[model samples]
Target chain A: MRKLALICVVMVLAFLPPPLLGEVDSALLQDSVTVDLPEPPAPPGNVTATDNPNDNGRAIRVTWELSADDTTGMKNVIGYRINRAEARDAADSLWTEASDILPSGTTEFIHSGDGEEDGPDYFAKNYDFYYRVHALTADTFSVSAVVGPVQAKDNWYNTGVTFVLLFVALFIILTVTFVRIARKGKELYIRPLAGIEAVDEAIGRATEMGKPTLYILGLGSAADIATIASFAILSRVAKKVAEYQTPLLVPCYEPFVMTVAQDTVRAAYMDAGRPDDYDEDSVYFVTSSQFAYVAGVMGTMIREKPATNFYLGMFHAESLLLAETGAMIGSIQIAGTDQIAQLPFFVVACDYTLIGEELYAASVYLSREPVLLGTIKAQDWAKAVVVGTILAGLLARLLVDLDFIKTVFEVSV
Target chain B: MKRQIPMMILSTIGTIFVLAYFSPGLEELEKGGSIFFDVVACFAFFLGGSNLVRVHIQKIARHNPGWGYSIVTLFGFGLMLFIGLFKLGNPLGIAGAPTEPGSWFQIIFQYCVAPLSATMYSLLAFFVASASYRAFRAKNTEATILLVAAFIILLGRTQLGLVMTSWVPDWLSIAQIPNLAVFIMTSPNLAGQRAIMIGIALGVVSMSLRLILGIERSYLGSDS
Candidate 1:
């Protein structure tokens, strides 16, 4: 009994000492905790803030030398924290954290703002700002000397895109020179496209078959280059349709495109002396939802089975579906698009395909205008220049391991 | 005068937009122009909707071929419009957005429109197979090369490719189906796409110049 009592007392002594002497033990624990605390990382140096160039006056670029401990000394820096003066001429000591704490090794940060005067993220333009760099460790930080009084502002020129400017200028000069040359009655030879030749043939066949000619301006907006090009082609086709006294159906994907098509058709009919025959119902709007549009168009194709189908404009995945449907219905499909991915699908299903630049050239070819021809010539010349540069760049890389030529072609945007 | 005014507007706006590319601090102007276009397109949406209704109603009145589809289209359009505007069956009531949970608008889209759209999109799978079949037919030298490349690609996508080429030595790994497929795609295919892209870029530039200079006016249906 005495031994059991002794064991019980021993257990109580092992577990109950801290609670019995809690006040005295707390002081000792605090002292030990203070001794193990982490030291602050060394301060970074040479901090600077400057106006970011080639942008609206909304951001300041802050940079600093790396903390000594980060690379060579204690290696304790987890990251660097950036703080900016909240207002113009605000004291450096009174600052707001600019962004998320930058991870270690980055020595620069673009302190951007929301570009609004009232928003929480706003950093006012033409406002003076100061910055401080804090080398951070797990539990403490060492602040660098303040540096700034930098004002955010904009630059007139974006030097990063200087190469782009040079190319654009060259193109403009070339285009102007060729256009002037064209105006002087100089003949420019443009290789004939099979698709352009087939347009008349397709229309004639549709006329003979006594069926409608379906002209889809595609799903592009009225402003799209391909859609604009198609408008020219459609005008010519509408005139021919009027001459032949044949039906021409134009189902549009966009409302504005439909309006434009209606105008072009009416004008063509007027030109052909068949203004009274022009029906406003001929050009109508369809839905804009992608697959729904496809479903609607497919229904028309299956029902109408138009003798000739002309799909000319910007298309997407629906290109294959539409072309394949046209093919199944045994329609003579003449397709044109600058979309490279859809080109293969069109080439496969359509009787004739206008690949890439051919779509743009189609309208010009039909119009046969000197000014438009000049632009085509300019395009060819530009393509030649691009090809020549690529060749030269390749040769330089292959021969002397020179990458200098490529740097000239590297556009910022 | 009709053509001249539009051309002038086109050239002036086009020039300013082009200038914005090379100049700083003009981004706000571009953004404003983009917003203007969005507002115009938003208005155009009503034009499209009204036209849709008018066309379908005409079809029904005339009892045209496929008049049944016109009824279906009109019903779907009207029902969706009513449901969306009223926010009927919305879990959060009228205060919530039209697309909120349990709304009839969401339900119909989830059940009807989306599935119908998917059905149309799924047709592409069968269409692609058919297209590939025709595209891969060995009719000529180019077709033969395409067939070979396509065969390699199909094989590479499966585990059988690794097993089939396992006997080949590591030094000749370039000849392996997977590696060959990747090489064809990244090198030859990319090169062709880039070439086409370059041509397209020049075409866009040329076409834009013509429009901006008012050298082409057929799109406006003008003879002069």
Candidate 2:
């Protein structure tokens, strides 16, 4: 019986699977021996996630310090991996990989969120976002403690331009106050502009020569401030032409401007007590095409040989062409434009030129109206304030390292 | 009623736009205002086109002194309008862009109008030369200074300034012609430009206020 039982045990042992037979040997080896492995890289330090300021609130800025072991002893670290999760999710929630392989030594990453309504990667504004940085190696990764709950939100007011806003408010108040004072029959003084004085002489010269006075209102629409200012000067010139009985030719580049010019000329004629002399055909629309209008004006100058030419309002490349043609025709030319680039052309080609603000000042100077004169006074005061601020800023920068004064002038929006 | 109503509307719209500029929340209102102006201007183009046609036709009918030129103007205007409006010769028909490739409107614009505009633009070079000759005359102290500045600017823009100043030592680099030209442009020139810009800004502010307050009404052709 003993022999038979031993035989059965031996047979069972022989028939067992190889893995089951090897399990006892593997357990013994694990207990007896241990393999050496390198330690994982240290996690990044001082991780921060914050909303990027002064923006439309579509981004979060993530920053972190390098791990201690990254570039030192062991030096197993290769790069970094950035992970993000919504703050509203669970503490152990699954994180989305924002970047898998940020290069070594990177300390900052700006995670821009799409603001478009239909964008696939759209990130909701004002929602808190959590961020984590992982120090990565060939074999292992060590993640930093999650830096969290930063929400991006839009600011209604850009506090950066507070200084500009205050200055503008002050200027408006000063101008309105002066306008009201002038309306109460108060006389205000404005220095005469040489360009304004030259207008009458140019028109008178045309009268003496028995030739027409050509006025070009430029290519700007009636909504343009320069064009509006030109209308004021045109009113004065039209009145003078009517009184002198000299033929006036006003060619307009814009339709609305033509309508405005016609009304201004007719009013000026009536003001001069020569309503019968006003001709509707005098003020008319030329072609709206820039060069086409230039060609037509050049043709008129060549054919009619106007004695006096007045070029005013906003001008572009056409400025030199008109001024040169007028100069060639031996016409006494007076040009005024607010375009800084075109001013040089006018100055070189025309007899008298209004430089920058002089175009705006010319109208008030020509009319000598108390209300307009008051605005000029207000402008002078504003200019003084600007000059004072500039001087103060210069002094402050030279004397100290503080940037408060400079910041006041730095308009961000 | 005619003058007062327009002035009131101008003032109200102008004030609203000014307010919208400073407030970021009201940015949409600013955009709306701009769109409104563009729409109005588009409609105004019809008025301008009709007036252009009417004036030229009158000159043609009366056999005016420039009647020959009027005929050319009318023909060009009519041709452009017909081609552009119908999108003639466009592969995709009227639904296609007026300036689409191979279209009659595109061909005319590219071959005819473009070259004509370019010719006009090129004439600026001759005008510049003539104007510069007259302006650079050293008749006075300021004119002499201006002439010197112009010469420096012109030379600095070319390789001549660098070749001429190559002999200068590094220690006195500021004395080099090109360096001097740069100094003039970045310092004194920038300062003058800024001053002029500031003056312009203040003038615009005052002028805008006058218009908004109804203080300046000569633009409406009403002295009162």
Which structure among the candidates has the greatest lDDT?
A: 1
Interface RMSD, every prediction, one decimal place: 1.8, 2.8
CAPRI-style class, candidate 2? acceptable
Model 1: per-residue lDDT, tens digit, A79-134? 99898875545665678898788899989999888565678888788877788889
Looking at model 2, residue A230 earns an lDDT score of: 90
Name the best candidate (by DockQ). Answer: 1
What are the Cα lDDT values of the candidates?
A: 0.85, 0.84
Model 1 bad stretches (over 4 Å):
A1-38, A86-94, A118-121
Candidate 2 yields a Cα-based lDDT of 0.84
**Pairs that collide, model 1:** none
